[model samples]
Target: MTSSFHFRPMVLMASSLALLAGCTSSPRTPAPVEDRTTMGRSSTPTATPAAEAPKPLPGSENAGKPGYYTVQRGDTLTRIGLDNGQGWRDLARWNNLTNPDLIEVGQVLRVSPPGGAVETSGVVVRPIASSGPSSSVTTQDNAGNKEPTKESASKPNANANAQAMQFIWPSQGKLISKFDANNKGIEIAGKKGDPVLAAESGKVAYVGESLRGYGKLILIKHNGYLTAYGHNDKFSVKEDQLVTKGQKIAEMGNTDADAYKLKFEIRDTAGKALNPVTLLPQR
Candidate 1:
């Protein structure tokens, strides 16, 4: 009876051990999977577009272009020709203008000589190549005959000796203004209808009120030099009229000036202005 009891207890313990092994071997629920791709969104940054700049106005370009010039307001044909290295007559001929005094703003003109076999003798009357102190007048009579005059006795000796054209005061007055970059000439205050003399002897190149800021203007060409007399009450001489030194060319007035005054200037062969005070004799 004691041996049977021990055997039975051993068999019961073996069965309990077998039951625990089987329970451990059975499958268990899997741990939840971790998501890595969508954790905190993308790390790269998004791009953005930039804005465009404004464009320039039409016809505003080509200011520095050669062989052509775009006319601005207040511009005259004479002024344009002087600015370029040509005579106003040549420009008129090149452009086939019936009236040299008429030109509109924004008109594109040919600054260079025209192509083809064209007569250029029209330019000989006022040649840019014949610039110097030598005075040679080719004045023609009504019969188309060349009239000769003696060398002007009024020409200053200093200027003649230096091979430069002599210049003189255009009117008797007090100098109210001076020359500058913007002010291309000087202003001399005088009485109304005061005599405005020719600074130098030459044929009148232009006479009109076509140019703005200048009233009843007169442009004279002396050898390679040129002079401008502005703000006149009345013009004593007409275009193409021959003028002598101290000769009355106009009557000074307050046409475009603040007072009764004459605006005078002296320009070189290239149409570059020289100080009138520097060229005019001592007052």
Candidate 2:
């Protein structure tokens, strides 16, 4: 009886094990990994692009160009130029202004480095060329810098006179008023509307009328000297202008007298008045 009972229990255990084996998990292929290459790149920092700096557009304000000027009410090319320390003609030429008088309001004007002013530190006292007036205006300097006017006037082919500072005449006329300790410089007499030529070549230092006795005045800084021409009926040149020899600087007239007469003076940059008679020729 005991042997039969043990055999029946063992047989029942084997049947349970056979059922468990049928439910065992099956081997898998990991769902055949999807090809993400068709889904595009990883959109991460390593795969993303970087931003670039913006470039300046053409005609922009900071396009590495020069400064510009605008016209306002009651602004003329000559008047604006004088106020800004520039030459009147240069302003017109820079803007391609058909006529200097035609500069209208809201017009834009260009400026260069050597616009119309004398902006240097040194002053040069040059010499009159012996060859003549035409060949005397040598743009070339001897050492590529400049020779003293005294030296350049004496040398014929030594070199160009490229020195930054040089003195020239303010106006051409009969020097009526002579330089005096009591007075400043000599006076040049002209008609009510005579054209006053430049005494030498230099830049216009000032313009317009501002004095107790003087009617209208223009100041030019040449070499080491500053020349002043007063009592002008009209001025052809403006402040801070680079002028040439024998060029018409102004229309001579009597702003303070019954007739036309120019009260002229020469002063160093330090404001010490000079006697122009000593500097002018005896005619």
Candidate 3:
């Protein structure tokens, strides 16, 4: 019986060692974990940029005010007078400039007459008959002959009576383009050497290629308006020369244009470009 009891204890010890050996032979594996350091940041969107504003034009602050003009680069007294609807001589007299050609950039000049009243050299009168006289009592001279009326005695100034002026077509051709926000004038498509006529009676203000995009340009200064003829292959008029309505001023060509054309524009005294079609007569 003692031997059986000792054998029982030895069997229990063997079983305990076998369990420890099995535990040491194999270890449990841990589960895998995800990396979330930049999880939300990777899915985030970026902000969009804002749009830029348009740049203001030069001398825009003085727009709509006709009494003054700010001299820009490449400006001359004649060009300024043309833009302001006055003669160059008149501009010289108004500003009392000793040298009209000497003008600096950003210099302010008086565009309008002093006290806002234009000075005249001679008197203008209406005919007595046209004045609604009740009787036809003609004034006889000492020679017993009919005396000339005051209307015949004095001639009216052309520049003073320009509000009633009219305009005509500058060229005969198909209108390829029209005036818009991007285009300052209308384009008339024509063959090279086609006649470009003056839209109204005026004195030529500028004649040259100085103006960009307007090749061989001619700027005519009417009393209250200014007309432009651009992209001409040949010029028929010179600067400071007087031109009547329907007079040939230039020849259509593809100077700055892609094709043979005449670009015509009409501007006010303030140098603001206007749609020429509005002022031209209907075909």
Q: How far off is model 1, as Cα RMSD?
A: 15.8
* Per-prediction TM-score: 0.56, 0.43, 0.56
Per-residue lDDT over 53-122 for candidate 1, one digit per residue giving the tens place of the 0 to 100 score: 6554333464556566788888878888656534577678777779977776776777556663322221
How big is the positional error of residue 261 in model 1, measured in Å on the Cα after superposition? 0.4
Candidate 1, residue 2: the lDDT equals: 89
Better of 2 and 3 by lDDT: 3
Q: What stretches of model 2 exceed 4 Å from their correct place?
A: 1-175
lDDT by residue for model 2 (44-133), tens:
546467788766432245333445656677776644544443445555666676877776555566643235443431334465345543
lDDT against the true structure, per candidate, is 0.74, 0.61, 0.76
Worst 10 residues of 1 by lDDT: 119-128
Clashing residue pairs, backbone N/CA/C < 3 A, model 3: none
Return whichever of 1 and 3 wins on lDDT: 3
Q: What TM-score does model 2 achieve against the real structure?
A: 0.43
